[model samples]
Target: MTRSEPDVRAEQEALFSTGAEHYARHRPGLPAVLFEALPAGYGRPLTAIEEARLVIDAALDAVSGIAYGVAHNDPELAERGRRTLARLRAERRAPLSPTGDAT
Candidate 1:
């Protein structure tokens, strides 16, 4: 005997129904290192530092959920994120020397 499509959908729905709140509360967010990137750039509106932090936190948490899924090899969504991160590492730019040409 084979399960009907509705039966499969029902089972999947039940699995997440109980833990929705836990999922929302325990999620991770942006790394603190990213805050340096948010400084004012000429005419941009000044967002209150507190409000800006909340937004950044929410964004980080959301993306971390995505990255966690991707990192663990969830093929269903594994192809959906940044293609470069797995292969490429980031390099910080070196500061220019106080003296003349850095060359």
Candidate 2:
């Protein structure tokens, strides 16, 4: 039988609450290699639309990380998520030229 929305939500919440501690304890943190791989800009220049698309993709990734962090009470993950989100917001506000330079 299908469950109602509220019922599904309540069950999900219960599962998350019960599993959060285990998840926080067992989950591995982000690798140092990942931080090292982040660069100041793309290797090659991109158009304004390309830059915008990159920002949107990064924002979606950050949001997913934030949601997982919150659900599992992972402070380090949450902090990284916040930093990624802030960077994305700044990128979104700044205008990009056709050559991907800040305008």
Candidate 3:
């Protein structure tokens, strides 16, 4: 049987609250070697579009961590991920570009 909207959302929220807590806690940092591989603009401030891209990347990572945590039978990871998303939303009030979009 098909689940109702609230049911699905509830399930999702539950999973988010539980899964990924461990993973988020011990998440590893990118190695310096990887940064050295990039062409340029490594240390400079990000441009508008670039900053937007960073935000998108962070969101994607947080979501993945949450999902992964859920799949692995962890829950707090999801809550951590949700907090990250909330923070990102709060910090991203300004437009990313002159057109007010990443594009």
Question: Could you give the candidate ranking by lDDT, starting with the highest?
Answer: 3, 2, 1
lDDT of 2 by residue, 71-90 (tens): 99987676666776776566
Superposed model 2: Cα runs more than 4 Å off: 1-43, 94-103
Of the two candidates 2 and 3, the one with more favorable lDDT, higher being better, is 3
Which model scores highest in TM-score?
3
Q: What is the C-alpha lDDT of each candidate?
A: 0.35, 0.52, 0.54
Task: Report the C-alpha lDDT of model 1 over 7-48, residue by residue, as the tens digit.
Answer: 233222222221232344344364433333333211344333
Q: Least lDDT summed over 10 consecutive residues: which range in candidate 3?
A: 6-15
lDDT of 1: 0.35
Q: What is the lDDT of residue 13 in candidate 3?
A: 29
Residue-by-residue lDDT tens digits, candidate 3, 4-98: 45323323323432233333456546344433333232344445555555566667767987898789877866767777788778886565557
Global Cα lDDT for candidate 2: 0.52
Local error of candidate 2 at residue 13 (angstroms): 33
Clashing pairs in 2: none
Where is model 1 more than 4 Å wrong at Cα?
A: 1-47, 73-103
